[model samples]
Target: MDTSFLDSLSDSDFDLDLHLIMGKKSSQKKFATMLDSDDTDSMSSSTSSMRLDNMTENGLSEVQVGKDDLLDQCLDALYEKRGSTREKALASIIESFNSSLQNEFVETKFATLLQQCLNSIKKGSAKEVALASHAIGLLAVTVGPGEKAQEILEESLSPISDALRIRPETSKILSLLQCLAVITFVGGEDPEQTEKSMHIMWQVARPKLGANVAAFKPSPAVIAMMVSSWSFLLTTVNGWALNPKSWQESILYFSTLLDKDDRALRIAAGEALALIFEIGNLDKFCGENKDSSEPTIDEGKDSRKLMYLHGLRTKILGQVRGLSAEAGGKGSAKKDLNSQRNTFRDILDFLEDGYTPETSMKIGGDPLNTSSWTQLIQLNFLKHFLGGGFVKHMQENQFLHDVFGFTPKKKLLSGTEQRMSGSEKRMYKSPNSALSKARTQLLNKQRTLAQGRNAGHFAVDE
Candidate 1:
């Protein structure tokens, strides 16, 4: 609601600053040759005139500084010992990260800023955790090519690894995982790097899948992030990643999850499986290995992959049949069963119809077989959650009792946490927040009751 910040920008050339930060050259004759020899000397002279007497390491006072000098001032303010000043600096720096060239410039002191935030998580206030988490996620998504990104990986590993092992609060853990996801896929173009990152993430996250600790249970939102990250990696890197043994482990774990009570988790896992089929080269992997030295494809590593896909395929049949059978029964049991049928219906709908790769935007470099597997996932979502026809004769031949054992149906809110969402938070400052409004309503109600009691006494006096 305050326009006071705009006053500070009155003298700031935002457009020019952006152009200079991004290193864009203007073709106009007036500034055609950006920062020419003469301009460089003029910039140096102007920068030299700016006094630092009022500037502190923790804060920056508005002053006339050359374009070159502005970057230095922003850095000083960013690293300010004062938290508020540092937050302001972080905001400025985060915005500049939009430009890759400028992002590299910010990376000049990246380690320091990252360390400051990473350290904050240990003892910082809730507000501090929120800010630091956001900042870390931003840097993770940006950063540099292999070298700079590698530096971030090395430096950030300790803090993140500790956080994961320690199993901190839900918020902290989510933030940490989010940062991991972003960093791992820094440039989705590079399959090798992407594959390595996915491996690292799986190494860290797999432990939490059925972790003995209470904090490790993947919530709906967390599962969404985890599976989606895997899906993104699969889509980005293509099916080459499927060559690893971990692929089966990942797919096997997710296939069992198809029958999970949490519709969201089931959907995430299911969609992740679909994405794997679409991008993970199921045909090459289906009951076939390139090395002929091994036995038949079914007996090899692809054996389990095939079995898992078959298990998920048959599991879908039983699930829909069970739903139909249960819904046909009488009484309250029938009603509850019908409710479940609807939930299961939603989970199966995409598999039944929604998997359409033909309609999906095509990325270059994808193999033709990728579309075949994708079509298979859509046409026979139940046939092969990932990919099938590797052993078509084995369809519904085996019981899925082991792969998808019984999980007690949880009430919709059974495992839910107690935190309110951020829906009420608005962009601009409000005269009263939701909390303030609630308090005001309570105070007014109390006042009305008191007035009623006083009015009754006056009537008695009359």
Candidate 2:
């Protein structure tokens, strides 16, 4: 099958209508295109607040009824007999989610929403599966890290893994890969759980051969997405916690991908390699894992391990150097070539000078900084996966703020909102202030402890 069709696709291919919010569907383009910038025409909170003050009791009740009915209708639509109906319902759910963080909705209907999405993945068409996968990701994000988040992971992982076991369309594969990365990011609190997720992604890209299972080859697009999603999860893992044999083979495998015909695959592999190098536990990658029954390594083995590390680094550095200066070929995309060149150049600089590139971006006018490859990969992956919702989550989702160490500037009240009493004002901002600071600190501490364990300081010998 010609998989090149995937290369021509973009987020706009998934554009959905928003008329469902008004109890009907229209041909007009309503939802923001996926993987694109936030629309400037987004409804303003200040404007909505003012409108609320003017609404009569009946009008306000009608508005509430509209929202409640829309959600109920979408949820019910999931159970409809037609695939298109289920797809539209999933799309409407996606629009409502991207427009706002559905904290209260998830709190009340987490299990039902999750199970419905999972059912779609198991039985719906390719498009339906894609949308359902995306909705599941959003559900996990809204729930954040807690028992509920863990439950999402536990309930969804098997169904997602099962769906991926069969060959699917490029969009479906992309969605499932992204969904796996996201749920694990939010819910897989332990390194083992995270590693388990990574392993699942690996198997999808390169399934193990068995007597009944023929050797399966994934498309370049699938391979690229797998590498990216795999690297996204790698950002949270500590270097020392990784299996020596697995990552040793991974570094070598990625180096080979650098020579692939596909530019996207090359770029994805380059980024993954750069992240591995940035993590920096080369000795561990080279050394043989000593079992309890076996004696410790002797001097000869130690010298061999050191030699292997040096040779591996040299090979990877050569590949990076070559890619950094690669010339454009016949029929090559100038944009893709430039992207590959820029990525490799950054990797080259880091490998040679130990200078990881620093990135800064604005979230609601506040800066979010990432000074390492890991953070940068995590940020980029999440931004791409979140699509138009990225900005909304950055502004309002405390989970995201904590993950990126971002603090969106507090907005001054305007219109009718300014008329609130001092106590009301304090109460309004308290959730964004006090609880936020405490959760941020707690998350930071948990990450620190996780890193310490990854360092092998707290790990027991296997």
Scored by TM-score, the top model is 2
Candidate 2 segments exceeding 4 Å error: 1-65, 284-296, 411-462
TM-score of each: 0.47, 0.76
Kindly list the per-residue Cα lDDT of model 2 for residues 1-462, writing each as its tens digit. 887898777656544333344433221112111101121222211111112122213132333435545555567668777676566567767777877877767768889999999999999888888889988898877777778888989999999998898878888888899999999988887778988899899997778889977677899989999999999888777677776556556776787898899999998998887776666675444443444134565767667766666677777778888888999899999999899899889888877665666889887778888866777787888898777788998887767766777766653333235566544642112123344346445544544444333333211223
Q: Whole-model lDDT for model 1 versus the true structure?
A: 0.43
10 residues in a row with least lDDT, candidate 2: 27-36
lDDT of 1 by residue, 321-412 (tens): 45434434333455545555654453344344433333232112221122222222222321221112212211111111111121112211
For model 2, name the residue pairs that clash: none
TM-score of 2: 0.76
**Alpha carbon lDDT of residue 96, candidate 1?**
39
